[model samples]
Target chain A: MKVRVSVQLKPGILDPQGKAVEQGLHGFGFAVEHVRIGRLIEMDVPGADAAEVKARAQAMCDKLLVNPVMEKASIEVL
Target chain B: MRVAVPVFPGSNCDHDALHACGTVMGWDTIPVWHQEPRLPAGTDLVFIPGGFSYGDYLRCGAIAALAPVMADVKRHADQGGLVLGVCNGFQILCEAQLLPGALLRNASLRFIHADVHLRVERADLPFTSALKAGEVFQVPIAHAEGNFTLEPGDLADLEARGGVAFRYCSPKGEIGEAFVPNGAMNGIAGIVNVRGNVLGMMPHPERVVDPRLGPTGGLGIFRSLAAALARG
Candidate 1:
């Protein structure tokens, strides 16, 4: 099974990378109004159970990958 | 007084912290490697210095938080030993859950490297006791990720309990917005734990130990700790 975990800084948690992207878009004369930078983690597991993969990936995020206080993480099994 | 500065992989400021301890405060500062499971005997203070620990791989201070040395640091803190973390050291303490909140990237998205103005918010802890409340000092900050964020309830509790040690300030005496070099919520530059022994601050107090190079903001911090140790 393949699992993908997407993590993003929560609202009210300042996102500097996103702000820079917004500024860059304005500088390039583009109409893009907003951009939010998030992290994506892709991993492969031998098991075929989607539920287990998601649970395990979520655990990985909570324990190591993401800081729960300032960021939210979602895991998708594929 | 004996001081221990834990050195993690990529920790470049352990020597700076050690130098500050020995040269400025006249304590025998010992540099402890990250793999040590126990701190040195009769250590008065434990300092986690700034650097890109673990290359800041998963997140800043994430890997170092789980290092063997932290177990000893946690034990020392539980026993009321003074623990001071500066810059990446602050991130390590937060990641270790010794302090609340998380430090995110700067709001401007640029590596901010400047002598910032800081208003001392507390005058009791071993880290900030030397400065009076509302006193402004120049301390240089150099970090890509240094924005401090906390929940509203936590911020209120911190302020009410004198846990908020320092705040980012402008030369004009304003806080938040332009005064905050990074978009740190409420301009919180430093904080102490509920016990007031564990201190986590983004500013590098170890960098300004001498007046010839810059302002002497760093001296107050070391002096505060050394004085506290002597009183014990």
Candidate 2:
């Protein structure tokens, strides 16, 4: 099974990197807006069960991949 | 005082912290690896230093926050042990929920490196006992993400409880809009817990401890902590 994790800064947390990216897009005249950069992590797990895979992924995130204070992460198993 | 400095993979400030505590403060400072399950015995102080831990992967301080050593650090804080986090260390403290708020990327959207002024917002905390409230001093901050932010209620709460330790200031010590260097919310640059045991600040005091580096105010942090430890 493969699990994908997406980590984003919590709603109230200020995301300067996202803001800068938004500004950069404007500077480039992209007409694009509302950009927020997040991390996408993909991992291979031994379990074939989707629930098991997601659980393990979350455990990894909590242990080393994500910072709970400023970020919230979602996991999808395939 | 016995100081424990955790060395996360890629952490570069462990030596700096150790030298400051071991040499300058004349304390037994232990450099604990992230994999360690607990701090060495008789630890009076714990320091998380600045560096691009785990290559700042996932997010700044994200990966390192979950290291085994953090559990012990959290326990130490719960037991009222003093914890001082600087720069990246500040990010880790916030990640661990030991401190409120988060450090966002710099306002200029670039890494900032220079000496900036800070006004002591709370001198009653053990972290700032040597300084007086409203006193302005200089410290060097080198990081891409140093802009501090907190929820509206939390920000007010921190101020109301006198947990705010420092605020950006101008050379002349004038505060408010003109002094904040990186546009941090409410001019916050550092803070401590209500218990006054944990302190998280963006400036690198260890880098400025030596007079040859330009400012001595930075050295005062370690000196104050050392004095408190010695007293106990």
Every model's TM-score: 0.92, 0.88
DockQ of each: 0.69, 0.48
Model 2 agreement with the true structure over B26-106: per-residue lDDT tens digits = 888899999999999999999999998999876678777889999999999999999999989999998888998878777
In model 1, pairs of residues that clash are: none
Q: Write the per-residue lDDT of candidate 1 for residues B1-232, one digit (tens) a residue.
A: 9999999999988888987888776788899999999999999899999999999987899999999999999999999999999999999999999999888888777888888988888887777777787888888999988988887788788788878888899874567777888788788899999999999999898889866666677788777777788899
Clashes of 2: 0
Per-residue lDDT of A8-78 in model 2, one digit per residue for the tens? Answer: 87887766678888888899888876677888888888987888778888888877776655678999887
Q: Which ten residues in a row have the lowest lDDT in candidate 1 chain B?
A: B170-179
- Model 1 regions lying over 4 Å from their true place: A26-31, A46-48, B171-176, B211-214
